[model samples]
Target: MMDNKTLEKKAIAAECFVEVPFFDLDPMNIVWHGNYVKYFEQARCELLRKIDYDYPQMKESGYYWPIIDMRLKYIKPANFGEKLLCIATFKECENRLKINYLIQSAESGEKLCKGYTVQVAVTTSDFEMQLVSPDILKQRLTDYISGLS
Candidate 1:
């Protein structure tokens, strides 16, 4: 069951559909653990794209938002050829970008995995880590939230 906090994320999230390819399967025919990061990245990119703050735009704005931390919990094995619905929700963007992710079986709505990633902004030239999220990111997030209403 979803709580209010989680229900809130449904109002502010980006989604994508992915058909699991055979290449993504491990020897056991289940998706390998490491490949989940790539899946998260795809959804993350979609979230950034929705806000018009993807890597290219970030570079143009003179900052690089790199994943500084990540956590994942596997709930079930996803089989090859399964259609998956991936949701990426921008949960926070004050000190860092804290995005939550969910991968569910598109056919049955079973939650297969869940995770979150934290991205920290850094200067493109100096590589100086930012103490707070850059203005561009915060502004974009604000705009996105405003549009949701």
Candidate 2:
């Protein structure tokens, strides 16, 4: 685990606004539970872009990051057209990329959903899982975190 100060300095988060569309809702007029995964992806992509390590960059570095595990907890159902604010926070990236997400009402700020995803790096050519993160990832994260000092 990282110390408080290190966590604070290294922390990176991004927020994205989404309006529930009719197509995303189920017969009950509530957003489908599985749709939250897309929300998480949106926010996570934004966070990754902030550090210039988005998917394209990752692939360019010769690694394919595949999600190894994920979890989602729903607190409330969202209605169609309801505005939501999704926040994705970077948690850990030493050996793998771990990101936490929260979905809340844009108007009321009520928490509606929360979840996390863990991704492990694999070589693009051979698809061999990497026990340790690639140097490019480590260096970029280090630079970003150090910049917060």
TM-score of 2: 0.92
For model 2, residues 37-74, the per-residue Cα lDDT tens digits are 99999999999887789999999999999999999999
Cα lDDT tens digits, model 1, 25-124, are 9999999988888888898889889888999999999999888899999999899999999999877776788889999999999999999999899999
Which is the leading candidate under TM-score? 2
Q: List the candidate 2 regions with Cα displacement exceeding 4 Å.
A: 1-5
TM value for model 1: 0.90
Report the backbone clash tally of model 2: 0
Q: How badly does each model clash, as a count of residue pairs?
A: 0, 0
After superposing candidate 1, which stretches have Cα over 4 Å from the reference? 1-11
Where is the poorest 10-residue window by lDDT in model 1?
1-10
Error of 2 at 4 (Å): 10
Per-model lDDT: 0.86, 0.88
TM-score of each: 0.90, 0.92
